[model samples]
Each structure stands twice: as C-alpha cells, then as structure tokens.
Target: MAAPLDLDQLQTFVMICDTGSFTRAADEVHRTQSAVSMQMRRLEERIGKSLFEKDGRSNRLTEEGERLLSYARRLLHLNRETLAAFDDRSLEGQIRIGTPDDYADRFLPEIMARFARSNPRVELTVICEPTPGLVEHIKRGNLDLALVTHNDARQSEVVRREPLLWVTSANHATHEREILPMAFGRPNCVWRRSACDVLDRMHRDYRVLFTSFSATVIAAAVLSGLALSVLPECALRPGMRVLGESDGFGLLPDCKIGIMRGHTANSEIVEALARHIAESLDNISVPSAEEAPAFDLAALSAMRGRRHKPANLMPGW
Candidate 1:
C-alpha cells in the first residue's frame, strides 16, 4: 500500500500554492528551495498526479492540485481543532468572533476581561459590525461565532433576544427641540429602526439630524443635545440620560443577541467561549423600567421638520 500522506508535505504544498513560489514557500517552512521541490515531487508521486503546472515563470495549481487544496485547508483546520481539544485548559488557539460595535464596547469588554482572568492562554480576534455583516461572516464560516440582533429570517436556534430601551435627555423641557431629532445608525441597525417605528406609530414627526454607523458618533450626538437616541438600558450613561418611564410610551421590541457556533463538536475552546459569554451576560445588571428614560409625545411633536429628508440618508443602505 502507498505510504500515508505526510502532513508536513501537504502543509508545504499549501504554502507553495499560497506564495506561488517554491523558494518563498521554503523560506516560510524553513526548508531549502531544492528540498521543497523534492517534497512536492514525492507528494505528486504518491498521489499519482502532478500538483502544479509551470506556465512561463509562474507556477499555478494543476486541476488535481486545486482539488487537493480544499481538502488541505479542511485537514489543517481539523488538525488544529483536534490538538486544541486535547490540550489542557491552556486554550491557545485563534478565535475569530463578530459582534455589533455597541456590544463590543458596552458588553464584550467586561465579558472578555472576565474570561481572560481564567484563560490567559487563549488569543481572541474580534470584528465589530452591524448584524447583516456579522451574519454574512458566520454563514461564510469566516467567524467562529457572532453576536447579532435577531431579525425575521435571520433568527436562529442559537439566538438570544435582549430588551431594548428608549433613552432621551433627562428632561423634555431642557432640550427644546419640538421635532424629536434622532441620532441614528445605518438602516440595517435594529435600534435605529425601533426608534423610528415608535415615533411613526405615535404620529410623531421626527428627523434624523445625525447618522453614522459608529457608536461614538451616535453617543456624541445624544450627549451634545443635538438629538435623541434609542439604546439598550445597560448602554446608557450619565452623559446620555434615559427618558422618563411614566410617560406611557410604548417599549420597542427586544434586541436579539445571537451566539453562533460554526462547529459544535469540533473544539472545546468554542464551547468554553460560549459558556464564558453566557455567564458574563447573565451576571450583568440589565436595565429595569425604573431605570429607563421618560418620553413626552406632546412635547416631541412640536419641533420643525428638516427642509428635506436628505436623500440617500444612508449610503450603503
């Protein structure tokens, strides 16, 4: 029988495909250029097919090599995951996770701090974006997990919905803008939609005075008394106060927080990570109605509308 395929040889092959140069691949794998060529020749002999085709001065994967590259990536991923699982609590593997920016700053830091207190060996890669982008990454398997606000068809078995709260300046009279000016995020943002829908349903005429995807910009707008914003209660701070709770305003729908697992049984690192996240959120002090801001519709409807709604208010939306 043919000798079992060598993992080192397959890895070298992948490096060659990545760099498109045996010399460069050799430098990366710490082998001589001739040694690298010899390894590839042996790999092709064992597999019964040439791995690459030489065209002019460039090297490209042969049809068979292209097919092998896919399996090579899978094998690498599986091998890494398996080793991580067998290793002790020293969870020293790369984890790519995505979440909304609001959560990244307000919620994730605390969770990560707590997790790191225990698993100092683990390395984390975090990407902060809106729900749509995060979901796309999860579907592409580029992210090990993501936290997103649940939407209609995007809702999954791995989702958790957190209550969203409407927040405005402390006193309606202090901020004398009749048309409840809103500081909004991109259209895909659930918080922005919730804020707009609440105003529309109540027959409140409002204008989005400032728009941005950055949480800092939205927070700054609200703090400067330029506009009001809807955010999670836990996200509120002294600079940005909540509206009154006794104003009889309708509460917006809960913001969905999802935790997706790309591989359920592949690695304990993922499970430990999920567990750490859950515990972190569970221990947080969620905002209650008493802590929510008050809203006055009669006062809000008095402001004037913008000259125009500003066409294409959201660029990518």
Candidate 2:
C-alpha cells in the first residue's frame, strides 16, 4: 500500500498556496527556505506529480498542486479537530474578543458559531469598536482576540481578503450627481481617508455629506439614496449596487481582514479560535474585476426622473 501523506508537508504546501510565496510560507511554518523546498520535493515525489511550476520568479501551482490543495486543507482541519476532541486543554472560562462593528456584523456570526461548537464551555464576551480601539484593547491584554482591518504596520495574522468596491443604492441615481455625495466613518478611519485621497487624485467632485463612526448609520445613509460609499464585497446588501470604472470610480486596494491576539493571552484557546477564524475565511474570494458589468449611468438617471424621492449617504473601518 502507498504510504500515508505527511501532514507537516501538506501543511507547508497549503501555506505556500495561501501566502503565494516560498519565503512567506517558510516564515509561517517556521522552516528555512531550503527546508521548505525539501518538504515540497518529497511531497511531489510521493504524489508522483510535479506540484509547482515557475511563473517568472514566483511559484505557480501546477494542475496537480491545485488538486492537492483542497485535500490538504481538509486533512489538516480534520487533524486539528480530532486532536481537539481528546485534548484536555479544551477551552473553558470566559474569552474576551473585540472587532469593529462592521466586522462584528458581517463576520462574527461564522467565527462565533464555529467557536461555540468546539468550546461550548467557554463564555464569549464580544466588544464592538473600531480597529484602532480593538488594537489598544489587545495591546493592553483586555481583549483575548480582535478581528481587525489589516492596514497599519502591526502584529497581526491576515486571514482573509476581498475587493473593495464603490457602492450606492440600487434604487437611486444619487451616484449620477454632479458633485458626488458620500457617507464615511470617523475622521481617522483608514477607508474613509483612502477613499477621499483616491477621489482627490481622480479629481472627482464629491462632498462628505455625512460622517458617523457607526457603520449602521453610514449604511442607512447609503440605503436612503443620499450618498455613495466604499465597502468590501462581504458587507454588500440587496438594495446596494456595486459601482466600477464605468461609474468613474477607480479600483481601490484589497480589503484585508486579520486576527490579533492579546500580548498575553490564553495560548491554547486563542490559537484554536484563530485557526477556526482562518479556516472559515479560507478559499473564498470576490468575483474578478473582469466579471463586473459595465454600468450605465443614463439608465439610473432616467429612473431618477420618475422618482418623487427623498435623499440620504454610508462602511469598512
């Protein structure tokens, strides 16, 4: 019979795919680049197929490597789950976690549900604040974990990424205005500042019509047809339509979501929670830019002419 696949090797493989570089995967796996290369060589030999091919200076997965990736994740996840079932270090007591309100609304449900299933004895305490506040809480050891927008140079493990898109209410032609109306977060918010800077570079006519720290308030403004906002794909809702280059709004940077653990936190439980968060976010992506339809402003303008309408403005912080 064929020998069982090595979990460590598979894990290294997955990390390479996740990080898109051998050097990064080496750092993540705590192995030297040479050692990581050796592991992949052995893995490829065992599978009897070349797993990666050179694309310029970088490694691109071969068809065989892509096929192994899903299986590798499943195997590693199952391995973790099996060990957790018998581990005496199962989580108990209270775990304090923090996240921005926007993330708490969009991402907490999955993270919480997965966590609750594995550590039912643990009581979870959640705090909703902006990323800066959450970072402070984690740094002070007041929070055991924090989900944050990964922009600043900080100690964080980025777990998920998706496109940041321009958004406006589907029912309104508000985005068609001569001077674009916008809703944004607090003054210090990164997304708000970045979006404004990008608009300025494009020489777009826009006004920050509303400013609120609350994502709910900002979303309310957007839905009311008063303004346009920038948001990650996951936070999109039914009444919202994505705007693109066709709308004169240029592409924004990818939104990166990460987990930060407290400086002094429960090692076992915190690590477990982090793994669940990462796994839940894995292998997901927003549709490619090539797939976005060319939007027509004239249609929205025509629809606006028929509206006896009220006005409004909007989040990722």
Candidate 3:
C-alpha cells in the first residue's frame, strides 16, 4: 500500500490557502517560513503537481490545491473526532467561555454542540460580552477561554481576519443621509471604536443613533434603516449592502478573531476546545474580493427577502 499522507502537512496546506500567504501560514502553524515552504514543496512532489502559484507577492491556490482543500478539512476533522472518541471520559470540569455576541451567534453553537456531545460531563458556562471585556474576564480568571477581536497581531492565535464592512439595509436610505447615522454596541466594542476612529480621522461627521450590546438589536436597527453599522464580512446578512469608498465611507481595518486562554487554562479539555474552535474557523469559506462585488445592491434585496431570524439574544450572560 502507498504510504499515508501526513496530517500535519495537510493542515499546513489548508492553512496556506486560508491565510493567503506562506508567511502567515507559518506563523499560524508555529513553524519557520522556510520549513513550511519545504514541507509544501515535498507535498507537491509527492502528489506530482504544483499546489500554489505566485499571485503578485502572495500565493493563490492552483486547481489541484483547491480540490485538496475540502478533502484535507474532512480528513483533519475525522481524525480529531476519532481521537476524541478514545480520549479519557473521566475528564470533567466546568468551563467558562466568553465571546462577543457576533461570534457567539455565528460560530459558538456548533462549537459548543460538538464539545457537549464529546464530553457530556463537562459543564459550559458561556458569557456574552464585548471583546475588551472578554479579554479582561480571561485575565481575571473569570473565564477559561475567550474569543475576541483585536488589532494586535501578538495577542493570540488568530482564527480569521475578516474585512470590516459598513452595512445598511437595502431598503433603507440611511447611507444617503448627511452626517451619517450609526448604530453600534456600547462602549469598549472593537467595531464601535474602529468605526468612530476612522470617521474621526477622515473628518466625517457622524452621529451615534443607537447603542446596544446585542448584535440582533443592532441588526434590527440597520435592517429597519434606522442606522448604518460596521461589522465583519461574516456578520453581514444576505440583504445587507456593504458600503465602500464610492459609498462615501472610508475603508475600515480588518477584524482579527483570536482565541485567548486564561493563565490557568492548562487542562486537556481547554486544549481540546481550542482545537475545535480553530478547526471550525478553518473550515469556513471566506469569499475572495474577486468573487464578491463591492456593492451588489440588487442581490441584497433578494437576500433580504429570505433572511433568517436572528438567533436568541444572550445579553449579559
């Protein structure tokens, strides 16, 4: 039989595609850039095809690389699941998790569900808070793990870096108004700070029309055309339009979603949960700029027609 493909190399391949650069992929896998490059070269030689091609200063996946991505993700997930199945069942503890409402709604359900299924006795206490507060909670030992948005590259293991978009309801003319009206979370919210800072730097006049800790409430405000808000690409709904420079809104910085752990988070359970979070994020297919038009207002209206109701709000939990 042919020798089995290495899972570690497969993971490196997937990371390279996800991050869009060999350097970023190296940072993610905690390997030197040369090491990652060598590994990929070997992988290509073994498979007898090029996996990547130079696209300017960055790398783009070749056709073969694209086909292998899905298979690699499935293989990694199955490998982890199989290992977890044989893990010691005696591991049990209450794990306190903190995350922003946006991430909670988008990624937490599946993460928590899989964790619960695998470790039935491990109790989960999830807290919904802004990223700053979540970090503080982790530092104060109030949370075992936290998913936060930070601009600092050295903060934690970055799961994803999504472009921050200025979104408004397609039916609403809020973006056309003078002195842009904005809706955002309360103080200490990263998106709120980022929006305000950019507007200030650009000398743009804007007013805070609504403030809510709940993402659903903010979505409702935007959906009703009450105000425009800055959100990550993943948080955008089908019917929401992304504003750009042409739309009179300056570019916003990308939001880095990272996994943070408390000082006391040294248990196997904590590590397992972290792995799950990373894997879940890795599996998400973020659209490339070329694939998505900056302002596709026509499609927005269609998406709005079938928008699903927001998940249950978990404020101050």
Candidate 4:
C-alpha cells in the first residue's frame, strides 16, 4: 500500500506557496531552509511529481504543484477541523468564508454579528467573489464555507428563497426605452441567463449596456438610470423601483440562497456558523421593511474611476 501523505510536509508546502520563498517559509515553520528543501524532496518522491521548478532566481509551482495545492489545503483544513472538533475547549482558529458580491452587503452584517458574538475566539476572514468563483475556492480549499445562489445542479444546502425582481431607478425612465438597455453579470451568471432567456422568448429588443461580475457595479448602473437589471429581493437598494409584468417585463424564477461547506467541514464551530447563517437568513424581519445601505452616486463614480477593477472570473465561469 502507498504511504500516507505527511501533514507536516503538506503544511510546509502550503506555507512555501503562500510566502513565495523557501527561506521565509522555513522561518515561519521553525525549520532550517535545507530541512524545508528536504521535506519538499521527500514529498515529491512520495507523490512522484515535480511540484516546483526553478525559474530564474525563484521557484514556481509546476503544473503538478498547482494540482497538489488544492489537495494539500483540504487535508490541512480537515486536520485542523478534526482536532478542533475533538477538543473540549472553545474553537480558536480563523475560518475562511466566501459569498457572492451581491449577497455580501445584504446578508453578511447580521450573520457576521451573530457568529462573532457566539464564537468570540474564532476569527473570520471573508472573501467576496461570485458563486462560481466561490465554488472554485471551495474545491481548492481556499474557503471553508460559502453562501451561494443555489441551483438544481449545485451541491449545496438551499436555506432560503426570494423573488428575482426587475429593478430600475425610481428617478429614471431607463426601463421605458424602446430598446431596453440592461446591466448584467457575466454570461455565466444564472440571473443573467434567466433575464436573457425571458427577453428572447418575448422577442423583446434589449441590449446589454454593461457587463460586470460586481453586483455593486451593476447596481450603480441601475440606480444612475444607465440601465435596468434583475436582482434578487435582498439586493434591492433605496430609490430602486421594481418592474413587473405590468411593466412589460416577464416573470423570473425564484432565487434560492444556499450554503456551501468544505467536504470535511465537520468542526463544531463550522457547524455552529452554518446554523447561524441559516437562522439569520430565515429571520429576515430586520431587512424586509428596509433596503440595504446604498452607495451614493458620488461614491460609485469614484469606484468606477479607480484603476483597480473587480477580480476576473475563473475560466469557464
């Protein structure tokens, strides 16, 4: 039988990948640089893969290293979770969590508040990427938990549902245009596909005015009279008006919110956080009567003017 991979070596591998220096990784992990190199050599022999190759003055991950990274991260995460689960003491580690940009503003505050209060010792690191990106993160063990827009094929827990609404600026008549101009997510966004499919069926003359992965970017366009957009109920901001069948818009299917967890997300605190997320979303009495906080036009304009754009979606996303 093949020998099991060493947790210590895997941790070293991940540390080297993160810090981008063998010497730095050795210092952090309390090992001599030669010992670190030896660990990597043993790991390569065990896996029969050349994980890294020297490039000029630095070492870069070989294709095999990239593949092993995901597995290494998962194994390390699961090991930590397992130890934490068996311990009698309160959980005390950082949890990496993820959500779509659209859900971050609407759902995170309350959920984060609840989790922090309940698990004071546990640290939370949040990542805001779209659903497909979050899925990739989960697969790569970059995130321990994720809240995603649920669909039939995704392997996640559907925790809540809300209407997908057509929204326009209350102060603008953008939706009334003869050829409807719309702001939408990338082509793979489920909401974008739905909106496009409905428009095609109705033979509605519509053109995509803006394409972005950031919900806020799209929301800015919607609120500034730049275009119309379809967003889930929670994404509605103040000064946005909903369009319905009465406004010549077709019906859209309900949006389902889901929770994605690491394959080995069995730690007590992880489960506790999942419960908090579900309870928070289920108790929507707080947000139902009000819109999420809005970014004013000036702020959004500045955001657009910045050279830094939102992260690009992964390939095939």
Best by lDDT: 4
Query: Candidate 1 clashing pairs?
Result: 178-303, 179-303, 242-293, 243-293, 243-294, 244-293, 244-294
Candidate 3 per-residue C-alpha lDDT over 182-275 given as tens digits, one digit per residue, 9 for 90 to 100: 9998876778989999999978889998999888888888888889998886677655677777667777777789998887744677887888
lDDT of 2 by residue, 1-317 (tens): 88999999999988887776788888999999899999999999999999887655455777788789878987887787677667788777778889888777767887787678677777889999988888889878899999988986878888877666678988898889999999988788778888988899999999999998778888898889999998766666667777876667776777788999986647777887888888867734333334434333343333234332221000000
- CA deviation > 4 Å runs, candidate 2: 1-59, 284-317
> Please, what is the TM-score per model?
0.58, 0.72, 0.73, 0.63
Q: Which candidate, 1 or 4, would have the higher lDDT against the true structure?
A: 4
Clashes of each: 7, 5, 0, 0
Ten-residue segment with the worst summed lDDT in candidate 2? 308-317
Q: How far off is residue 212 in model 4, in Å?
A: 0.7
Q: Which ten residues in a row have the lowest lDDT in candidate 4?
A: 308-317
**What residue runs in model 3 are displaced by over 4 Å at the alpha carbon?**
1-61, 117-121, 286-317
> Where does model 4 exceed 4 Å of error?
1-88, 264-266, 286-317
Cα lDDT tens digits for candidate 4, 1-317? 87899999999998887777888888899999899989999999999999887665557788789789778876775575556555668567778889998898888988887666556678999999999999999898888899999988789999887777788887898988899999999888999999999999989999998999999899899989999999887787887777776677777877889998886554666787887788678655323323444423333233223323232111110
lDDT, candidates in the order shown: 0.67, 0.77, 0.77, 0.79
RMSD of each: 18.5, 9.9, 9.5, 16.9
